[model samples]
Target: MLIDWFTVAAQALNFLILVWLLKRFLYKPILNALDAREKRIAAELADADAKKAEARQERDEFQRKNEEIDQQRAALLTKSEEDATVERQRLLNEARKESDDLRTKWQEALRSEHQSLSEELTRRTREEVFAIARKTLADLATTNLEEQMTDAFIRRLHKLDSAERGELESAFKAASTPAIVRSTFDLPSAQRSAIEGVVKDVLAIETHVQFETAPDLVSGIELSANGHKVAWSIGNYLASLQKHVDDLLNVPPKAATKAIAPPEQQANG
Candidate 1:
């Protein structure tokens, strides 16, 4: 209003200087402190998140290890059961084999004992029968029986077949020792002369004959030249009877009765 230009220019210069001082000292310092606090809080949050992730990974690894241990335990149990079953089967087989072997041995032992008993029984029976027959024949022997036996021996020589005659003749001719005539009893002079005459006539050769008394002949007469022999005896008949008895004893009881006569009846006949 008064036309004072100098006073107005000085006041405007003072206001500009005040605004620059406020911005440089007060506003700039406060803004820098707030930015530093925000940076520190962000760094703490990132560290907490990294720690939580590591803990989760460790938990997962522990669970996997527990599952693997469970599988290993199950496999071990199955293997043990299989092994037990195999062992049990092996034991059963061994027991069965032993039982069969024992049974077989028992049967064989029974068969062997039965065979031994049968053989012993047969032998005893044979000895007793032979003893009885020998005693009976010996008691029945007589001088008349001896004479009859001598006559029978002579008849047998006369009835010889061609083969027997030739064998006897050859033996007599080739003999280095004299022909022997044996009897259970001594021959009477008449009987001896008859025998000598008959032998010479039948053979048509001059032959030396020796006589022998043999108690074992059992009412028998025998003539032997070299290895050839002609004989007649009650003992021969008894031996044939014994053979038949032996055959009967070997057969079963039912069959034996139908097969042959009893030993006593055979002896009497």
Candidate 2:
């Protein structure tokens, strides 16, 4: 229990020295290592945060790009569909036009064939009628009819106007060949002499005369002087009748009506 100041001071000094040693060598070094580790960990954490932000930005950009691509694909698909629809319509229209054209051609062909058949039938009928009439007239022909026709021709010649008589006289004067009188049948001697006298008296010209038979005349008489001819024939009346019959049947008209020369007009002459 005795108070030892020397010992106390010495112990205090020793304790202080130990504390300084621990602080300088152990505490300071440990504190420096911990501070360095903490500084490195803080730098690492900051780097990780920056990387995470960059990754998030990249993810957002990728999503936006994906959305844009999807929209583009949809637009392309829509455009393709529209184009296909238009093409389909165009093809249908072309097909319809072709069908109409074919139908029109078919109808035209049918009409043409029908018209040709009608015309052929009409032609055959006309020919048969002409044949029958010719045969009938030939069967009905008589000597009395011939006499009457010869007399009628003589009267017709005498009835010629001044101008016609002058033309006949001039033709006879200029003609180098003899005049010919053609009939369906031979005229009697008396009828021939009567015709010769009438021709000479009416025309006031002297020309040689010849009589000839022409069955094609078909109940007709024809007189030819030079290139001029005068004729009267039942064939003209038959032609008129045939034309009227064709009209009644509603046949197509000919290019022209056949002309039958009048008594006062130039005929085959």
Candidate 3:
């Protein structure tokens, strides 16, 4: 309760000085260290952020590369599938074409074989007919055949016109060499006499006529005139027939198939 101004003033002054000293030494140094530490932490944080951002960008770029690779793989697979489908279709078409060509060739071969068989059959039939005709003719070659042939030849001489008779006489007169006549049968005395009479009537000159038998003549009349032999026979007819066959075979027309009549189906009551 006593008034102490000097002590009070000194105490206040001492307190103010201690406060200033503590502020200068402790507060200022601590504040300065804290500020520097905060600045360093901020710089480190910024650096870390930049590194994270770079890592994120790298990850995005890797993901984008993977997506592009996947797309390219899908495109390649699709293209390969298309190419395989095209190849398969092309092979199928080629096989079908080959089958068609083979079928056509087979049909042509069958047609040719059938035609050849038919022609061979026709040729054999003709040959058989000619053989039978020749066989029958061989059986008819009797002793009386010579007499009949001579009578027939003499009959032809009588039917000759005046112009033919004069030509015969001229031919006989012009012939200095004797001509041998071919025959297929034996000559009889009556036939020879008949032939002599006809020859004398046609030529009006006496001449010696000889006869020969040759089986190769093929049933016909043959005469030699002025070193030229003229013949009319079944063999000549056959030769003409063979010529006609050759002409028919040279240009063959399209084969026409004959229609086969269908069997009638019985009506059910």
Quantify all predictions' global Cα lDDT against the true fold: 0.75, 0.78, 0.68
User: Against the hidden true structure, what lDDT does model 2 obtain?
Assistant: 0.78
Backbone clash total for model 2 is 1
Tens-digit per-residue lDDT, 1-269, candidate 1: 88668877877887787778877887787787778777777777777777778778888888998898999999999998999999999999989999989988998988898678755654455445445645665677623544555677779878888888888889999999998998867877777777777788777668988899986564467889998988876666656665686676678986766558787876886
Candidate 3, 1-269: lDDT as tens digits:
68699989998999999999999999999999999999999999999999999999999999999999999999999999999999999999999999999999999999899789756655564456546655665677633444544555666667777887777667766788654556544556676666667676665778776666665455544445455443334455656766676666654453211122233422321
Candidate 2, residues 43-93: lDDT per residue as tens digits?
999989999999999999999999999999999999999999999999999
Question: Candidate 2: misplaced stretches above 4 Å?
Answer: 1-7, 113-269
TM-scores of the candidates are 0.41, 0.43, 0.39
Query: Pairs clashing in candidate 3?
Result: none
Better of 1 and 2 by lDDT: 2
How big is the positional error of residue 29 in model 1, measured in Å on the Cα after superposition? 62
Best by TM-score: 2
Any idea what lDDT model 1 has? 0.75
